[model samples]
Target: MIRYGILSTASIVGRFIAGIKESQAGEVYAIASRTVAKAKEAALQYDIKNYYGSYEELYEDENIDVIYIPTVNGLHYRDCQNALLHHKHVIVEKPFTLTSIEAQKLFDLAKQNQCFLMEAQKCVFLPTTLQLKKLIEQNVIGDIRYIELKAGFPGRFDYDHWMYDLSMGGGALYGSATYTIELMQFLFDNPHFQIDGSCIKCPTGSDEICNFQLKMNHQILVSSTIAMNVPLKNEAVFYGDKGYIVIPNYWKSNHLDIYFHNGETKHYDFPYQSEFVYEINHIHECLKQQLLTSPIMTPARTMEATHLVETLYQKWQEDTNE
Candidate 1:
């Protein structure tokens, strides 16, 4: 079995471990945290065989073939770079890095080390998403012309210590933008796009709400709204000449509905125990064949999406004098 090492004790790590188990193609062999107590606690909680107080030890472990980084937004680059330098395959959680340059650098470093690397973008791999993709490609909706998404949750700064710190890559821009941006990229075959957007920051000077519009290929228009301090419909819609599609909770969606102008509606659902399993299993297959990069989650796609987010942040930062 491919041995996986986790690089954080973050709450999300538990879910990642569960996906690994469900994949059945890999095992959570080791985990690490900044503190021994936290590391040990996580190991026991997750049923991992080994634990380390520092990430370095886990990277050096001879048995661990891969590392999963679900660290904070700012640490994604550092952690992924460290793991790759040690010749370990890596799966860094989304918002892969704060900028396109960092994303590009990580992909280059992975190639240099001859190691596998990918962003943990679960949406593109879900059964429902894949099926939706097929339908779009087949023009089932008669040529998609516009896409819209509104995603957010009521998140307060008190509970999330790092979310308001820009230095820590905190903000709705980093926290919530990539999913919509990359989802557009994946669904549209990585089309050329330009972004125009703005954000309203919370009291702590972090973006809590962002509304961006992407002109895709000078044809399709993708409008996105992301709010971290408020609740939204959290849905993505694709409008076409013939009909429209709605995916509730597109991030971890199991179902979708399509409405046609002809007054017909279609619904679809593909339930699963854990959405993470598809991506985990995907990584398993790539590694088994000695592939160093994912074909679907390509480096170019990551860079393009990152560039979009960085550009928007820069624009707003200048306007707000940040």
Candidate 2:
């Protein structure tokens, strides 16, 4: 079994660790945190056998075959680089890095080291998400038109938490919009067409929310938004000449309703799990094929989607400063 090492005591890592523990081909063997107390506490809570006080120690551990880096956004680049340098496969949390350049560097290092690397953008692996992609490919909705997406929830940002700090890469656009952007990338396939967008920032000068309108090369237009200081609402609406598809709570959605101009309407529901077992299983399949990353979540696509977000933020920053 592949041994997994977790890089932080971050809450999201708990779900990922659970997924790893449940995977038949992998095990949650170790975890590291800046503080030994935190690492030991997380290890005990998650039943992890090995714990390290420093990330370097965990990366240096030869027994660990893979590292799951769920640290804050800004740390992803450095953490991933270190893990790859140690010759360990790595799965990093979304917003892959502050910029596509950093992401490319990590991917390059992974290639040079002959190790695997992937962004842990989990929604694409959901059964509903997969089925939706299939339906779109099958042209069940006819030619695609405009798509609308929105996902947001009021965040409890701790003053001590890295998420509230701009330098630490704290922001709704980078933190949450990564999911929406990646989903669009998955549905539309590469290059993602053109996206013209704007954003709203938090009092701290971080992007607290964003709204975007984009068009795919296939002539599919999309409108999307993400907000952190708001109630939880996640939805996506896909419009086509002959019909439309609506997915409510799409980030981890399990149900999809499709409507057609021909007076036909259908709803689909897929089983749900707190953790993404299918995504992890797909990773195992990629490993078996000796692939560096899963095709569905390719690094290029991740970079493209992530680049869109970074570009939006840059534009917003420019406009605000002007």
Candidate 3:
């Protein structure tokens, strides 16, 4: 079994650990936190065998086959870089990096180190999402033309939470927007897209809302709206000449419906499982095959998503400055 080392004691770690326990390909062997007490506490709570006070110690361990990083947005690049330098495979949380440049550097480092690296984007690996992709490929919706996606929830986080700090790469655009942007790319099979839209920033200089339109090569139009200060119907709809496809709660959808212009509707319900299990198994398969990058969530695709986010933030900044 592949021995996994966790790089943080963040709340998301518990969810991931649950998935690891459900997976047969890997096991959570160690955990690291900023303090020994914190690490020990997390290890005990999770029933992990080893704990370390510093991330460096985890990296130094030769037994760890992969390092799972769930650090804050601003720290993703640095932590992944350190793990790669130590010749450890890395599975990092989404919004791989704050900028495309950082993402490029990390990919280069992973290549040089001969280590497998993947962005922990569970949506792309989901059974429903895979089924959706297959259906799109078969042209069940007939020549895609437009896509509408909206995902958000009310902002009720503590003032000091990292989500409210722009310096820490905290913003709705980098948070939930990662799912929206990547979903678009995955569905359309085009990472080369342009964005034209605006954003609303909170007093802390972080974006609370963003509305944008993405245009892909064949003139496919995608409208996306993400906000943290407001609640919206969270779904992704694909419109085509024949009909439309709807995936409610697209990020974690377990079912999808296809509608035809002939007034026919077909529904598909996939077996429900923790969203993390699929991606964890995918990573494990890649590691076994000695693959450096995942075919489904390639580094180039990650850079493209990051670049789009950067572009949106730039537009927000320019508008705010004026």
Error of 2 at 203 (Å): 1.8
Badly placed stretches (over 4 Å) of model 1 are none
- Estimate, for each residue in 1-322, the C-alpha lDDT of model 3 and write its tens digit: 9899999999889988887888877899999999999999999999999999999999999999999999999999999999999999999998899999999999999999999999999888888999999998999889988999998878567657898887788888888777877887787676467778877778888888888888888478888888888889999999989999999888888899999999999999986647688888888889888999999888878888888888888877888789
Residue 290 in candidate 1 has what lDDT?
Answer: 96
- Taking the tens digit of each residue's C-alpha lDDT, what string does model 2 give over 97-174? 988889888888999999989999888888888889999999999888788898876757754566667688887777
User: In model 3, which runs have C-alpha deviations exceeding 4 angstroms?
Assistant: none
Model 2 TM-score on a 0 to 1 scale: 0.94
RMSD of each: 1.4, 1.8, 1.6
Clashes of 2: 0
Q: Residue 289 CA error for candidate 1 (Å)?
A: 1.4
Model 1 per-residue lDDT tens digits across residues 1-322: 9899999998888878888999988999999999999999998888877999998999999999999999999989999999999999999898899988889889999999999999989998999899889989999999888999998777456635897777788888888787887787888888888889888887888887889999999999988998887888989999999999999999899999999999999999899988899999999999989999899888877888788888888898789875
lDDT of 3 at 261: 99
TM-score-better candidate, 1 vs 2? 1
Clash pairs (backbone) in predicted model 2: none
Displacement of the residue 262 alpha carbon in candidate 2, Å: 5.0
Candidate 2 residue 15 C-alpha distance from true site, Å: 1.1
